[model samples]
Target: MTTESGAGARVNCVVDAEGRVALELPAPVAATRPHLLLRLRPKKGEPVTVSRTVPLEAVADGPARAVLEPLPALEEGRWDAFLLNGPDDTAPERLRPGLRDLRALVDGHLRDRPSPVAVRIPYVTKEGYLAVRAWLRTAHAEAGRIDVGDRSTTVTARLHGATFEDGAVVRLRMRGSDAPERDVRPVTDGDHLGFRFTVDHEDLAAGTAAEGGIWDVFVHPAAGAPPIRVARLLDDVADRKASFVHPAARAAGAVLRPYYTLDNDLSIRVATG
Candidate 1:
């Protein structure tokens, strides 16, 4: 896949979410099926095998390399890649109606974001309150309350149960400042379906926290209040917010917010909302 983003090559592409996520290999794919496969690893967990195959029907204008689309609020790094059929394939330049249709499908995915962004607010501690503004330096497992606005779970659980050791195949990597990448995988859904994904964050342990800085994760869902965690990192120095999430091995998630302050009082405060 080519880097240095430009209008990359266009090929029929399909990205799977929670539902009927399937890909059928094109005739060309008959020979390169293995390389086309991507093994997505969740945070400290075993990698989940995405076995679907998407055959390139109509090739369109795209880059020489697969690119992680440059969107307004997309996390900096994650799994955003697609490989070309040939090393020096120039199919994107000479586009046709068939290829044009393929380009539209891929572009649609980039333009449509199906994820959440972080919105943090902080305040000084009050009589019974521990000041909400300090979530900036807090961890998701420790910081606070989170409410997903009553949205029902999208991915099924029975499909994504833990079938392997945590972190063995899965992976968790921070992409952008506002939020990191959280991914999960399960063995099978209750109905015997193959698998599913849930949002979750990789434990940014204290040892890994930047110098003079303490990193924490939270579940503050209000977008106006400190998060409340029901599950948390192994050693949450901050707090927890169970009301917002149901901890599942296949759940994936990320965090985004403003700046934070570590004060002389040994207390922390975050930037404005």
Candidate 2:
């Protein structure tokens, strides 16, 4: 098949219920050596990359098609997709997003997967490139419906890859501080295995002086299970810090607000009045 050399090419992506990814290139790629390259967005440390070749039959007259199976999991991060038309030495072409089909992901089909729940969401980046937000969690506390009250905030969350024991508790620990941690037992409903906990704004304000601080939230699923971070990752929203804002409550001359961090982990910020 013929291929395009321009960097302005685009890719249409469709993610199945089982986390399988299908990619369609704007133009046909080399049938012999077409590949999909996923490079994790760089940070302070070294970035990770994964590559998968396209099968012969998946390509046809129209756009070149390639499928990335769910197995051999990807690292948890935002990965940018590229189209490699030639050998490994070929310059990869950045792919713009087009016609993304992610209905299965919206239906929450992978939520019941086994331990180390793997989730991959394909989306268009702010730069208009095709990228994926991935997560691999051994134990996850997915923050669900939240109710903000005058004096307290109630959070209901679902536990995955871990079961709640009799002494299950949620911990609120101050970030970058030595302050003692506060623990509150969540009322677990056996029917759905979901739990809900309430955080008092006054209690959070009392934990810190006038300056106030940020408290990271965690869930202790059982007696021996390691603490799992409370986050919201089951949906399509890649970054929730700015998109998912919550109303702040005033108590003890302080403003208490719950918000999602840059990493999408749930945290409460207390600011002195």
In terms of TM-score, the best-performing candidate is 2
TM-scores, one per candidate: 0.22, 0.89
**Measured by TM-score, how close is model 2 to the native structure?**
0.89
**Candidate 2 clash pair list:** none
Look at candidate 1 and tell me the lDDT of residue 92: 15
Error at 118, model 2, angstroms: 0.9
Worst 10 residues of 1 by lDDT: 264-273
lDDT by residue (tens digit), candidate 1, 177-266: 654433333333233322333332223221122322223322222223443222221121222231223322211132222122231111
Compared with the true structure, what per-residue lDDT tens digits does model 2 show for residues 86-122? 5653677788777787776675723655688777888
Candidate lDDT values, in order: 0.24, 0.79
